[model samples]
Target chain A: MSLKVENLSFSYGPRKALDDLSFALAPGSFTALLGPNGAGKSTLFSLLTRLFTAPKGQITIAGHDLGQAPLKALAALGVVFQQPTLDLDLTTRRNLLYYAALHGLRGPAARGLADEALATLSLTDRADTPARNLSGGQRRRVELARALIHRPAVLLLDEPSVGLDAASRRAITDHAHRLADRGTTVLWATHLTDEVGPTDRCLILHRGRLLADAPAGQIAEGTTLTDRFLALTAETA
Target chain B: MTPDPLHLSPNIPQGGPGGGARPPGPAAGRYLTALGAILHRELARFLGQKSRLVAALVRPLVWLLVFAAGFRAALGLSITPPYQTYITYETYILPGLLGMICLFNGMQSSLSLVYDREMGSMRLLLTAPLPRGWLLFAKLLAGTLISLLQCLVFLGIGYAWGIRPPLAGLLAVIPALLLTGLMLGALGLLLSSLIRQLENFAGVMNFVIFPMFFLSSALYPLWKMAEASPALARACALNPFTQAVELIRFSLYLTPNWPALGWTCLATAIFAAAALYGYDPARGFTRAKG
Candidate 1:
């Protein structure tokens, strides 16, 4: 498994945030972590990224234990947090370069990688523009570009397209698919069912519990994925 | 129509000069890289906002040039050890003004944390592959650098007004400013981790900042406080800001107060440790709601 999470559990005092959550993603596979607001998706993302460690769980990213070898595990993963992390005052290229340096890429090599990442996101033209000057979609793309600059084996994205328009959202989702096609294991957390296609694997989480984990096509069957998702979550609600 | 071959090279080494894949060994280089990124980003934020810099400097300048002048005669000059001869109240309060800059900058850094959390940039920083402690340290260092710059600017103005310390004193003052900045910046980090909302931060300033400043030996010497109220004097002596101010005050005269150094170092360690704990992944202070 490129990414494996076993018995992942976390809580905020008495309130449970993730309850025995477990899953695995093969390399080059696209997985969607689908859940509604307050459904523990973000909490799970936090744990997976080791933003905070889960008390009872084992998370292995690219064969490295997350707890014992956090830096190594994290180095193999690229993350696009739900919040935009770019420095608004700095140009897009500068923002990417900053992230590049964080992953230990420096000098001309860092610059070249930053350029390639920007080009991958089709953001080369806007490289010199300050983040504040970019549109919401453009800024989101810049964020994606920054995450990919390090080229980790596993990519974790939390709500990468929360507030974008339909066109932008499709563009981002397509980009994620392309990344998987390029052999990166992707775990994309989001609420929108349409974002997950028939072939994609789906993990439905509700109230801090894994409700279902199966192929998207099988879960949808004859009906649409959105209707099935609402039915599954609403039943628990 | 063509498809690129799937590349699965586990043999890829880690820490190459530049590559998409993670290198083989421990990612020691990430520490410097994360530090560099956070520092660069924070410096941009600190300098890009010209208005904030102007306001930060102007606030202390007004306190030193105007408020100190108005209250100059009321406060008699004392020939303290740091003061070779009779010194005006304005000159006496200059160090305190520098302390004020660090205090306000520290709180301002917390404000940025709250803003970043709300805006989601903080999540980005926290999720990076580097250790969270180093990331916070980098942020503290950046804040210190900015505070030092502001202090230097304020000192430049003081020199123009003929309130000059020995030229050598300025060099000694750098380490003093750094210590003060780190201590206060750590306190700001602790506050930022604890407080969830920007509105709640107002209470921090009122409850924490004002009391720490007023009760400390910033404006008045501990000896004066001893005369006025012995209990208050003890409190002032123990207050961390008192040590910071005393450190800056003595350093400006090329004097080293070991007690002040000890207290400042202890305070810095405690504050930084608490900040690290507060932001720790397992027991950090972030609310479940976010």
Candidate 2:
């Protein structure tokens, strides 16, 4: 497993956020974490990325224990936060280069990686343009490009498509899928069921507990994934 | 069971910061890189809004040129370390004006953190692969760099107005500015992580900033406060801003106040630690919805 989380638990004071959650993803697999609002997806992402440490469980990224060897584990993971992370005043290329530098990529290597990542996102033409001038989709793509500049083995995105238009959302998801296809383990957190296909692995979470983890095809046997999701969460409610 | 058909490529091992070919020491190099990125972003943001630079400069300039003019006679200036003889009130308050610039910039940086949280960019920053402490420190360093630039510009303007410090004093002022900048920047980081909403920040500025500036030894000497009220003098002496102001005032005269430096360093450490704790995922302020 490229990413392994076991018995993960977290809380915000009195309210438990993630409850004994355990999951694992192969080196080159895409997993969708499906849940409604307040289902602890964000908290889970925070724990996985080591934004906060969980004393109750363990998280290992690319064979490195997150708690013990945070830098190594973090170095193996790339994260796309729900918020737009790019500096709006900087050109897209500059933003990527900045992120690249953070991971110790400098000189020609950093420039080359920034260029390649921008090209991968079809944003090479917009490299010189400030991020603020880009459309919502373009900006999000630029963020994705920045995340990939380090070429991390594990990519964790927290609700990457929230405010994006349908076409843009589709493009972002497709791009993620392509990245996963190329061996980057991806944990995509979202509530939209349509974004997950039947063949994809899916985990349903509700009120900070894992309700089910199965193939999307099996979970949504007869009805739509959305319908099944609503039914499952409603049953627990 | 059917095989999971979606095959991603093999995990490509890429060199990360302080990893690969880089020799490891204290990880300062990695932190410097992160700090560089954050500083670049901050500078870009400050420069992008053409109004911000003007506003930052204009506020202190008005206080120096106009407000100081009105009070020049009412406030009698004595020979101070930075002042040779009986100087105008305007000249005496130049360091205070510089302090004010740093104070405002620090608070403004905090305000923007709240704005960033609301806008979602903060989330991106928080989730970066680096340690949260390093991230927050990077932010502090960035804010300090900007504040330092503003102080330099303000000093240049002061020179234009015929308020000249010792030529050697300019060299000494850099370290002073850096210390003041870090202290204020740390306070700003603490506020940024603590204050969840932009609306509530105004209350902070009203209650904390105004009092800190007005009651501090910024506009007047501690001895002056003592003449008015011993209690007020004590308060001014204890105020961290007073320490910052004193540090700058002495350094601008090429003098070092060891006590002031100690106080500023202590305050900076406390504030920076609090900010880090506030952003800590375990027990910090991130749990509350921004």
Candidate whose lDDT is highest: 1
Model 2: what is its DockQ? 0.32
lDDT, each prediction:
0.84, 0.81
With a 3 Å backbone cut-off (N, CA, C), the pairs that clash in candidate 1 are B13-B23, B13-B24, B14-B23, B14-B24, B15-B23
How well is each residue in A103-165 modelled by candidate 1, as lDDT tens digits? 777778789878777776777789999999998888888888788788888888999887888
Q: What does the TM-score come to for chain B in model 2?
A: 0.88
Misplaced by over 4 Å in model 1 are B1-20, B23-28, B287-290
Encode model 1's per-residue lDDT on B5-102: one tens digit a residue: 21112222222211244433445666776687778777877788899889999988888888888888787767987788998888788888899899
| Candidate 2 clashes between residue pairs 3 or more apart in a chain or in different chains | A181-B8, A182-B9, A183-B8, A183-B9
TM-score of chain A of each: 0.98, 0.98
DockQ of each: 0.42, 0.32
Q: What is the alpha-carbon RMSD of candidate 1 to the true structure?
A: 4.0
| Model 2 native-contact share | 0.23
Candidate 2 lDDT by residue in tens digits, B1-290: 22221221223234331123232455666667777878877887777787888899999899899999899878876676656678887777888888898899889888988888777677666765578888887888888888888888889999999988887887798888888888888888888878878899988889878998988877888887899999989988999999998889888887778999899999999988888878887766666762
